[model samples]
Target: MGETIDAGGVDLWVERRGTGPDVLLVAGLGDTAEAWQAQLDGLADRYRLTAFDNRGAGRTPLSEEPLSVPRMAEDAAALLDALGIPAAHVAGFSGGSFIAQELALGRPELVSSLVLVSTCARPDAYFRSMTGFWHWMAERAPSERAMLEAFFLWVYTPRAHADGTVARIVEETLAFPHPQSVDAFQRQLASFVRHDTLDRLAQITAPTLVLAGELDLATPPRLGRVVAEGIPDAEFEVLPGEAHQPFQEVPDLFNARADAFWREVGARG
Candidate 1:
């Protein structure tokens, strides 16, 4: 069953599963807790998993105030506090990875280990342009199909496209019940453009694993490398033949790597 936690001013919709050391899963922009279904299905048996919809996504209601990465990080921290969790292994995907970085930097004691997947440390001009296009599509796309088509073009590789994997994902995305609204999507895009953690990464003392897809264009491997280099002693790995959503594209490989990392961290504690 799902629960609604009063995270400061926002009511966050959260799901908890399995029974072990806590592992918090944070999704990307316009994504809900449902985005982590693969991870929950694959890793929940081994570790206690907590997935939540961000303020503007899923059943979480958005406020009129602007959304920022730091605020989202606070919401994550607040959720944990509400549940009486001292700390947990934190894993974040894409824009959610940005929130994980901020959480570690701001509340180091609340993070046991950090996993950043398909994420970037800062938004460059190219990143800005990409998000700008997404924002435009969110507002002006003639239909959901057109928006999905445009998103798939940048999020998946030629291999996924050839194998019909992208098509399946697009269909699932369209059928999702709690899709993000255009205004919420635009807010997320603006927040992404404003996110920059290059100077603050060193403040995060938690052990971090930086995973990137070799074929990802949105946030390329080079960007992941920068993130790893910025965080002291962070490990970086590139998944072969994967795109932006490596966790979904290669579930077995992604789950194995993530499970190993979490287990190692849990053992240390």
Candidate 2:
């Protein structure tokens, strides 16, 4: 079950599952705690997993406070405090990874290990233009479904399109109760474009793993490499034949890789 927790000034909708070492999962843009369903289902048996909605998404209320990567990171820290967890293995995807980067840099003590899936340390010209295009599309798309379809073009691999996966996801997202508003989406997108942590990554003391999808146009392996290279000894890997949302497209592989990394981190400590 999910509960509304006062994580700082935001009432974040939080979900917890399984037991053992704490694992915090941060969702990407336009995603909620429910977005990590595959991970919760696949990895819950081994670890205590927590997922929460960002202020501008899902059941979480959008406050007047300006949304930024650092603010979101503070909310994550506050959520950990509210749950009485001193630290956790932090993993983030896309925009969530941006927030995670800030969190690790600002509060390294609260991050046991870091996993950045489909993320970049800084936006190159292509990334900046791509994200700008996404923002523009989000603003101009005629309908919610249309917007989703346009976004999905790059989110999933071509195989997913032929496999009926995109259709199923669209149907489910349309049926979801706490759908994000266009205004909120644009606001969040603006915050995401402002994130840049390439220089500060070296300060993160936590063991880090950066995963990118070989087919992900949104955040390609090259960007993921920059993140790994900047962080002292962070490992980088590209999942072949996968796109942006590999954790959902291939849960078993994603879970095993993440679990192994966490176990290795635990063993060394």
Candidate 3:
């Protein structure tokens, strides 16, 4: 089957594998459908896994229109509609978690359940400063490698750094054909900084699981706590000795946690 789908005005590149209960995986800032590679590999055996590139990432073109959380949530909704899915378990990471929250609130029926990973309710002063610094680095970094190197510091834990996982990922990213442009990275970051759902999170009705990494410096456990507290009945857990991108860092454990939660949600319904 073809990869790209006409999601409203944008052609979003999507990949689907397996054929059980539907699962939609949303990617984070400067990421593509490829971000969920681990999930697809680990959990597709038991679920229909669909992952896609957001606007300005992967095969999705960087539209002239500025990106926003609600707009991207609409994009996700469009993908589900076009695919003929009534609802699916949704899992999102980092910036993608913001998109998941908005999607659940905006189109509650489209989301059967949600797993928000390394998410925050709102950006704090430090968050703002870090994003601002990344914005500067995106434009001023001597090379794309340097930009990625800078990003790795916050995305992965020291364990990954010492274990060659970080280097392997950097090489793979550099080798990937559809790399996100500096402008695209900055544009996504722009929308991310503007996302604020702290006051409105209570409206999310879907079964929710919020997970944070103990070592996550970007959106710390405290930030993830705020999100969990806002959403009534949303379960929150902190993965010990993990970092921001636990999905990538420890795919087996991450996959088990998400798969269990999703199955429980399905069983309850």
Candidate 4:
């Protein structure tokens, strides 16, 4: 079960499990805390895993104020403070990676290590165009089902689509209640477009790992490389035959690598 916590005037729905050192998982754009289900199942056995719905996602209510990456980062930090956690190993996917980058830069002492999956340091023309198209589709789609179906095309690989994986995902997504509203999604897209940290990555002191899906169209391998290069001594790896949601597509591989990284970071501390 999840509980609501007040973080920087926003009430965030957060869930926690297992025990040991803390690990915070931040989800991608318009994603809920449930997005990290695989990670929770895989990592909670060895670590105290926490996941939360970002503002305007899941059960969290939308804020009237305009959203920004730095503000979201502050929300994460405030969540930690509310939980009385001094620091944690932080992992983020896609847009959450942007928030993670901001969190590390703004509150280095609160992040023990960083895992950025399917992320970019800055939005390039390709990213901007892709997101723009997504926004356009969301705005024009006849229903939420139509919008989700269109969105999944860009998130999963051809193999997933060919193997019926995407279809299953689409079913679940369509069935999910409290899905992101059109207005909230537009705000998220705007924040994603404005996200930029290429020049400030060097200031991130946490041990960082950047992972990219070999077949990810949005935030492709090249973008992941840019993020890795920007961060000082950050490790970069690519998962073969995976797309945006590698953790969902290949949980065993994703969990194994993530476990190893966290273990190594724990040992170092």
Candidate 5:
């Protein structure tokens, strides 16, 4: 489950599991490949699952300078090339979704299909404020624990926040052996805000699925609609009673919708 690829002048860490059609999982800001632990275990039996640490995070060494969202997208393609995978069914959540769109638009030949979850094409003022809060916590918080607590609060719904999910996320955040730097996080945040694929989404030729959680204040349901509307052949699925990370909160429902869409599109392809 370990692979390395040189991208943007840095060595990036990549992991994979299971065996079948390639399915690459991309994570959000401050997130590592382990963020897809749920999906890796859930979907591995059905597909060739691959996940990687974005530049300057996780096992991947920090970049020499800040990275742009499009650069991160190219990094993904580079990782796939290093693995000798020409194309993959790509799925991304949050910031990862933005990179996925960029991948589809910029490297159309490498994306066989796409799943855009809890994502948006552009960052509104509110989104900026929320991400700004994360930046503040990562830099100025009294402790990493406090910073993670605040992050869990922002990423999850009220139900999850109250149901010990926040505690679980905090625990996972602490378990990361590698330390994260505020500078790296700021670079990623700035790149996220710069993401605006609205104008280029129409050029994406892959069959796309836009899925959202009902209570996802982070990205909201309308974000999913915007993506679905932009692509000529995209489908939207709204899961009730779910929040930001639906694939983790409700794996069965998430996989069913995704599996069905992949099947439908694979048939058409």
Candidate 6:
């Protein structure tokens, strides 16, 4: 079990389990800490796993004002400060990766290593296409079921669609019982759309592992490659037949590879 703590000005939700080197998990846009359940379950036995909901999402208190990506990174750093964690291996997915990059740049002392998943180093014209799709969703105001189906196609691989993970995610989202706040959702979308980290990446010194999904239409392999290449000594990998959410689509492989990267990076420390 875990508890909520006052992080930055928000009531940040934090959870910890297992024992070993600390590993922090950051979720993607519109996702909660629970989205990392697969990673926590798989690596808990061998790592001190920490996962928290970003401000304005999940159980965490909403941001008073819409936050920029750098501010979100600061919120993450504040959460670590509240927990008295000096440093830890940090992992982030999608836009969360942008936050991780900022943490490494702004608070390097608190970051041991980095695992950036399904993210770009900088916002490019490709992000416009993805944001346009989200705007389309906003305009449609489809039923939850319909929204879930569209998002599933956008985030998961064809294999996951065939195996029913998409339906399972939809069911989980629907069962959560909370009404979706369209305003909050739009704010999260705008944050990513406005985030551009192209020049900041070269300043990141954290040993990095950039993961991508071959079949991902959003944040495609090229984004991962460019990001990895930007950081000195960064490694990159692509999960075959996977989409935007590789950890969800290929949990076993994703966990093993990510865990290994963390281990190797931590060993250097």
- Per-residue C-alpha lDDT of model 5 across residues 89-137, encoded as one tens digit per residue: 9999999999999999988999999999998988889898988877777
Q: In candidate 3, what are the lDDT values of residues 1-269, reduced to their tens digit? A: 32989887679999999889999999999888777888888887899999999999988998898789889999999999999999999999998999999999999999999999999989999999999999998889898888888889999999999999989989999999989988888889999999999999999999999999999999999999999999989999999999999999889999999989988998899
**lDDT per residue as tens, model 6, 101-134:** 8889999999999999998976678788778677
Q: Report the Cα lDDT for candidate 3.
A: 0.93
Pairs of colliding residues, candidate 1? none
* TM-score of candidate 1 against the unseen true structure: 0.97
lDDT (CA) per prediction: 0.89, 0.93, 0.93, 0.91, 0.86, 0.83
lDDT of 1 at 64: 82
Off by over 4 Å in 1: none
- Model 6 residue pairs with clashes: none
User: Cα lDDT of model 5 overall?
Assistant: 0.86
How much is 118 displaced in model 4, in angstroms? 0.6
Model 4, position 193, has a per-residue lDDT of 92
Against the true structure, what is every candidate's RMSD?
A: 1.1, 0.8, 0.9, 0.9, 1.4, 1.3
- Return the TM-score for candidate 6, rounded to 2 decimals: 0.96
lDDT of 4 by residue, 133-208 (tens): 8888888998877888789887988988899988888788878987888889989889989999999988989999
Point out where model 5 deviates above 4 Å. 7-9
Q: State residue 189's C-alpha deviation in candidate 5, in Å.
A: 0.9
Residue 73: error of model 3 in Å?
A: 0.5
Per-residue lDDT tens digits for candidate 1, residues 1-269, read 88998887679999989988889999998888887888888888888999999988989998888789999999999999988899999999899999999999888999999999999989878888988889888778899888988888888889888999889988988888888888888897788778899998888899999999998989999999999999989999998888898888778888899989987777777
For model 4, which pairs clash?
Answer: none
Backbone clashes in each candidate structure, one number apiece? Answer: 0, 0, 0, 0, 0, 0
Name the candidate, 2 or 6, with the larger TM-score value. Answer: 2
Looking at candidate 2, what is the lDDT of residue 209?
A: 98
Q: What TM-score, computed on C-alpha atoms, does each candidate reach?
A: 0.97, 0.98, 0.98, 0.98, 0.95, 0.96
